[model samples]
Target: MNSIDSVTLEVADPTAAARFYSGAFGLDPSRVRVRSCEAPTTGFRGFTLSLVVSQPGNVDALFAAALDAGATVLKPASKSLWGYGGVVRAPDGTIWQIATSARKDTGPVTRDVDELVLLLGVEDVRASKQFYVEQGLTVGKSFGGKYVEFATAPGTVRLSLYKRRALAKVAGVPADGTGSHRLVLSGATDPFSDPDGFAWEPTAPLTVAN
Candidate 1:
């Protein structure tokens, strides 16, 4: 069956995009509806992201094919130094990423970056950082603390929030303004939304990982 694993848009008007998403994408009015008060709170204007995944399956290739067909790629696909590897977006504003089969159940010997951290898009760098700070985040000194170093626990993996532009600039890739993406809790996380309205919380704090 044809399926999408994840969806995130850096929209200006999330309230308006709520309708646009439901109609244009044919997302269910009921299922597509995500509120921060509920679960997945990761969007502009603070809306929880509703991610879709195929059941009993692994269909990364099919999803990749869909992007090749007509999806406007804002960013090209590439391996991420942060562990999880996937394109940030396609032009005309659509975000796509694969949820790799790197579950903890699979064991650290077979873990993928996908199982550790998740990326998110934000409007402002300092503002977004402040949001995470308000959530009681203790900033780490990575990229000069421009990228947040939060915890997933004490002994698990690490996730950091990076500005799209800076990351792309450093990587020598074009920065395709990606808006809102979800950092789904993989390990023990204390999830909370940053002040800028990005969904994140400390499931685990910063630590070393091999």
Candidate 2:
């Protein structure tokens, strides 16, 4: 089964970026990697990393923690048509959404964040959905021509696609820009980029440092 092993972000300083995420969101420092960029400005345009938690408090606390860690608040937490959620921009300019559903979850507490969903804003949802289906990902739930979500195995991050303009409206960001995404997804055997330029590379084998 295809699973997202890790998501890498490019930043000016890997150590600093790793530290910020680890401290603010409880992400393992090893999971975040950064590289130098010569570009003048870097901002999120087409994708967002979603943190799905089990409880409403989790959403609030995580959102607060992000703000306390020097993250720029894009949207304050509130109940929305989509559920309870808030948006924040990481120090490195990556956009993140922390949210929880109204549905009650009786699952045991495993972690502060229950699951990660990589939501990509694609120019064409239909074409992007077809491309992923051909790459062996099963469709979980798709909405007419507006949205598509992929089924993922337990403990794996799920991938979702939505129209660029729609996603921009949801995230409160502009829909036009051209530059490096500064994000990389790993797990697929063959490296590929979706219609929106989100790159997925094969998961590298873990190494033991003796």
Candidate 3:
């Protein structure tokens, strides 16, 4: 099955973004990397990087740290019908959502992330779903024509699709965005951009930072 190998965020300051990710989310370069770019972009970027945790406390933990690390709160951490979650925008303008399906903690609270998801907000969920299906991805879940998730290999970022307007609303940002997405997916597929203009590149060799 086709799967994303990693994600790179094009930011203006790679060093600062690296520091923020490290301090806020305990993330390493292998999980999410950063590169320098000043591409023109405004409003919503049409994507969100989500960290799914095990309980509410973890959500709160990361949320507070993100705020302390200079992130702006888009939506305060709170409980919902689906579970507890919150949204924040990193210093580099990348929107992130920290959430958990379990309302209560079953074990000691930790910053351990359960799943890392890269959700692309597409203009047409159905059409984008079909585009990925044709790219060798197997559908894991689908909700009518609103959302679709693709199964990913263990330890890799899971991919999902959501309606552009609904996703922007969920992120608490305006739906209208222009210029570059400022996001890139490194996967096994030959380099290609999706229907919505999200680019995918062939996986590159990993170079662990010192």
Candidate 4:
């Protein structure tokens, strides 16, 4: 089965981005990587990285850390219909959402992230869903034409598609964006671009010795 191994963000200052990610989210390069790129991009970058935690306290912990690390608040952390979450924009122009489905604290607070999801804002959800399915990804969840999530291998980043306008609204940004997505997905499939121009590069399979 094809799965997204990691995500690479093209930023103007990779050093700063790496520092920010480490300080803000305690992320390592294993799942998220950064590289230097001055690609012209405006408005929303057409994607958002979601940090799914275990509970509301975890959400607040990550959210506060992001603020202290020089990220601007796009949406304040609070209870919502779905759960508790907040949106922030990194200094390098990437947006992140820290959230959890648990409304209250279930246990002691920790900075541990439960899952990392890469949500791509595509022009056509159905078309993009078909594209990923054809690339060997199995559908994990689907909500008609509004949203679709692909099942991924354990310990890999979750992949999902949402309408560009809806995704922008969720991230509290405008839907208009151009130039480059500046995002790359490392996966098991051959290098290719999705319908919305999101790049995917193949990762070498692990060799097991007998």
Q: Which residue runs of candidate 1 sit more than 4 Å off their true CA positions?
A: 1-70, 75-93, 97-113, 116-118, 121-131, 138-141, 153-159, 167-210
When 1 and 3 are scored with TM-score, the better candidate is 3
Of the two candidates 2 and 3, the one with more favorable lDDT, higher being better, is 3
Clash counts for all predictions: 23, 0, 0, 0
* lDDT for each residue of candidate 4 in 32-71, tens digit (9 for 90 to 100): 8888888898888899999999999999999989889999
* Candidates sorted on TM-score, descending: 3, 4, 2, 1
Q: Put down candidate 2 lDDT per residue, 135-175, tens digits, no spaces.
A: 88899999978999998777777889988888777777777
Runs in model 2 deviating more than 4 A are: 29-36, 39-43, 103-111, 205-210
Q: Which segments of model 4 are wrong by more than 4 Å?
A: 204-210
lDDT score for residue 137 of model 4 = 92
Where does the lowest 10-residue lDDT sum fall in candidate 1?
47-56
Report the error of model 3 at residue 94, Å: 0.3
Models 1 onward score TM values of 0.36, 0.88, 0.96, 0.95
Best by TM-score: 3
Best-first order by lDDT? 3, 4, 2, 1
